[model samples]
Target: MSEVALLLQKQVSKGSWVNDKKVALIVSGVVLAMMVAFLIVPILSILSRSFAVSDGFGLENYINTLGTSRIWELGLNSVVMASLAASIAVSLAYAYAYALQRTDLPFKGILRIVIMVPLFAPSLVQAQGLIFLLGRNGVFNRFLGFDIDIYGFWGVTLANSLYTFPYAFLILSAALAVSDARLYESAVVMGAKPFRIFRTVTLPSTRYGIFAAIFVAFSLSITDFGNAVVIGGNFNVLATEIYNKVIGQGQFGLGAVVGVMLLMPAVISKLLEKQISKRQHAQVTDQSTPLQIRPNRLRNLVFGSYAWTIAAIFLSVPLIVFVASIVKLWPYNMAFSLKHYAFDVQNGTAPLWNSVGVAFATAFLGVVVVASAAIVSAKFKTVLSGPISFLSILPASIPGMVLGLGYVLAFNNPSNPFNMLYGTFPLIVLLYIYYNHAQGFLISSTSLKQISSTFDEASTMLGGSTLRTLFKVTLPLIWPTLLGVGVFFFMRAMVSLSAVIFLITPQTQVAAVSVLQLSDRGAANQAAAFSVCIMLIVIAMLLVVRLVLWLAGAKNVTLIR
Candidate 1:
């Protein structure tokens, strides 16, 4: 009887192990299927459409697109503008990040917050503010009597530089945040000058980070549509070309060809970034001492002035935008009025409310989808983990305009099973979620990785099922991160313009599209008004999330992961 009882206990333990594996397999499979269905299939559809000629599948579209001098011109414009913007953004951001991290600068917290202003508003705000400040009849030309023309290549380049600055700052800040103090001490003992030490030790230490920032800023500049659309008068890039071909001329094949062209540089840059980042070693280890910032008045004064200048440039955009939104007419009438807030555009404030709904849905659904993917990839040991992980990050390489175009080609057909979802708000929500999936997945994955696996081992030893372990052990520890991811999704959905541009319809107009329409129709103040509303909504959402975190006793948790 004793032998039989012991055998039964062993068999029960084996059964629990099998159950856990099965659960993991199912979750992993589900996540993989969703990614392939949403991400891989839509991109394949774009490729298919690009090859679909009148004579059958062929390269005629590519041949025709490449045959034109016009296409080459546009391509060159895109490359030059992207290169300039990336170079400018990366240089300024590297210095800004260095000032904040390396020196004891005054107003560090306020400057940090100010620099993130671009992230809070739509990308077009920079272009709009530039127009208000530097255009033909702008503040400078009208009030200050300066002749400035901000309407072509230089205009687009400057706007994109500002748009990409915060992104570069984020990357470089993290890179500079950690370093071995011993290296600095040794350099000082060798009697090296500050400039020499910076060139030798500091620059080399952050080489990978600099490369990564360039890659990101370049990709963002090349793929951005909002800034170029608003201020790039006749200085067309590939992003605007895709819009004109697909939306303006109704030429899907031509648009798909342009999409393919745009995708190449992003993929190449991502590959290059991966190769370069492999050389980056851990800067802080168990034996390493943290770098301490020593106070120097001269250093503080110089960096403080530089950092605050950049911050002021960032703040100027929204500040002018808010003023423009409320003024009766920009640069013409000084009287303040709420006339632009009337929103007499096509859909009016309905699109703003629609955006709110979409943001809420995206926030909820994105948290579930991204968090599940992260957990499955990080915690599970199934065969599906590799594919799931690969697909989760694949969206980052695909440009938003390309993805939006792919959605049109994929779902707007009669034979397609998901044809019914075309031009629907649900589809728009899904686009927002997947379009920003990579960032959310990385955030959740990073949080999960910091959590020890011993919890899983201990839970399994007690015969708790995998799902049980996830709900009881994993979710509790990472719920705050998941909340942050939700807030991120909400913020993105509010301000995103490119991916949803091709997806919005008459009945499904969103706030970002509304801004585009108003700006395109020459209703600059109305567009500013609409942008202000969107920013307010985002700020309110952030405050609410922060309040929730504070009430839940999770103090000092950053909401913008």
Candidate 2:
């Protein structure tokens, strides 16, 4: 036989090229098309409108937006608040994470759980909780015989700190959880002081995590709308400015300008996050031993006190909401009542049900959309692979409010074919899937990478098709991670505000928006009641997922943070 023929025969015998690449190509094409239509187009639409003027395309909008003294003031305000919030959140989160992950603290599990309570509700809930405790007629002020204003810069900063700190805690906890114990042992043997060891060893080890936490906290604080909307008062920031421009003034052009302005910090933070994430993963090693904390009474006591303080702060929101929900009147009547629980009387339970429906649809559809793209990018090499992967994660860099505005500008016009879905429920689901796609894609892609391609080869050798191998072998193994993605999607969509705030109409009102409305209408008790309902629903859904995973014998599944 000829040499080429002999090589071809050898390859055929090895079963490496048996499966066609058409499947990968086809999947890649579909993913690319969807991303272009949904993600890329909308952003371009917003950018396009920002430059449009009545005469023709020009910088009139940009000039007007940037020329204004108020815009500059708002920008400065956003930067100052974001910086302060980031600093405070990172300090508290680092302490809380170290306590739970590196110290012999008692009740660490409960503390960790309490820290994550903020994640179960909207960021506005924290603002509401702050109001309940410190507003003019607040419980604390009434009891202490002093009025404290919870409506301006201080309120925004404090509420944002509470809302954004949990994210930092999760990142720092993961970083602290993975380290080489041998380094600590060596330092101990060399007679390193505890403080010195912490300064050199611990600080250097978690440096990337610290940066990650700061960037994430900054991005979240700057982009956050819920907390700012509730307590911002006359404190103008870019996010609230965008809300005012679009909803309050009907200035789509000006809103787009602010959207672009907000994108700068988000993009910078996301870039830093990506680089730090790459560096932080190096902490995990094959030969590394997990760090174990030995009982040191003084050390444990200090860290435990710090952890409990943070837990109390974190729990304050939900606790206040629960109490305020059942109370008949604030600061006047101490008597408990069930009247606020009758959410059906005013806004009814439809908004809550709508939120559940949106969340469910997002979870199911998000998995399918993100997983297909992940599978193709993870397993196959194609020209579209790089672009597909980049597009999949680009949503994380885009703020939810910007993306929502993009959707409005992109889909609500007659020139767009997607105009049919302008106010429909599916548009909200699609917006959410795009808004939160990055994390799910990362999880699915990581899981797929850990799986062996040998399974595919073996299946091919056994006369199974590519589809059969994927279904019978690949998917079954990664279902646990997929389940985690589903739960994450559900939780985020249930509590989502920014992405859907611009999208909701009278018919498509959701619980989060409803809470905002109630609070805006001065129905504090009803808003609190609604906030509590959302939290309970999220918790119950989490429990249901955990139960399902347990019944399925999936012990490795992590359904919550």
Candidate 3:
């Protein structure tokens, strides 16, 4: 009887394992189908369009695009500007992150928040603010009696650097936050100097992070359209060339060719990033002691000054933007006025409301999509796991403008089942979700990775199914992270410019696009005012989410992820 009972128990365990695997396969299949439909099909459609010729599909478009000396000039400009911006942003962000994570600086929270200002507003806001401060008739030229010109290459480079700074800071901060105290102690015992220890021990540990930050900043700078359009003037890059080709000249083939070219650098950088990350060893082990920040007066003072200076530069952009928005006239008059806030541009304030609605929708649906992808990829061990994981993070390598162009190419055709969604708000929301999917997926996966798999095993042993364990155990533990992901999607949908630019119809114009239009038609103050509204909405959203987290007894949880 004892042997029979033991055999029966073994059979029951095997049954549970089979049930769990089946469920994982189903979930993985569903997620993979969605990614292929929404992500893969669109990208392929655009690539096909690039090869389409008058007679049939051919390489005529690529040959023509590459043969142009103008195209080569734009490509060189993009590579050079992107390289400079990425270097500047990464170098500054490294110092800023080091100050926050390793030093005993006061008001580190405020300094950190200050650097994130660029993330709150549209990317063009940096260029707009620079114009207000240093344009031909800007504050410096008009009031400070200095000749200044904020346009063309240097202007766009500076704007891109400021725009990409926060992203780098986030990656570097995470890298510096973890260190094994034992390594530092051993170095000190060997009588290594501080700089030598930093060069040998600190730098090597965070090398992966530095590479990651460089990749992010480089990708952002190279693909950015907002800053280049606003401040580039005659200095065009590949991003603007794509816009001019498709939107201005109505040449989808040429635009598609540019889009394909844009993918090359991003793909190469992503491949290199993967190789570098594979070489990084685990920094924190079971027996590792966390490195503690020791207070040093000179160290604090030096880093404090450096951090605040960077913070002040970051703060000044939005500050001047607010000042410009309310002033009667930017450089001619200093009197206060609310005329710009009236939003006299096309569609008045409808775009702002439209963006709010879209942001809410994106937040709700994005949480479901990204959370599902994360749960399936992280929790399941299925044959589909490798493909699902690869596709989920693949969007990070594709530029926003390229993805937006792909959406146009893929869904605009009448034969496509998703054609009805082409010009609608739902389509725009989907674009925003997938355009920013990789980041949200990463955040969710990181959170899910922290929760032990022992809970799943225990639940299975007690006769719980995979779905039951997910809801009864996993969701309860990671719901806060899901909330953070929701907030992230909300913020992104609110402020994003490039991806949605191609998707918006006249009726579905979002606030970010409105800012672009206003700036384009030379309504600089109105653009500034529109930007202020977007920033306020983002801040309000953050506060509301924080309040909800506080009420839920998860007060320590950050909404930014």
Q: List the residue pairs that clash in candidate 2.
A: none
For model 2, give the RMSD to the true fold: 2.9
202-283 per-residue lDDT for model 1 (tens digits): 9999999999999999999999999999999989999999999999999999999999999998999999999999888887
Residue 489, candidate 2: Cα error in Å is 1.1
lDDT score, candidate 2: 0.87
lDDT (tens digit, per residue) of candidate 3 on 397-427: 9999999999999999888898999889999
Which candidate gets the maximum TM-score versus the true structure?
1
State TM-scores per candidate: 0.97, 0.95, 0.95
Q: Could you give candidate 2's per-residue lDDT for residues 42-104 as a string of tens digits?
A: 899889989989987899999999999999999999999999999999999998898888887
- Which run of 10 residues does model 1 get worst, by summed lDDT? 1-10
**Worst-scoring 10-residue span by lDDT in model 3:** 1-10
Please give the lDDT score at residue 450 for candidate 1.
89
- Sort all candidates by lDDT, best to worst: 1, 3, 2
lDDT (C-alpha, whole model) for all candidates: 0.91, 0.87, 0.90
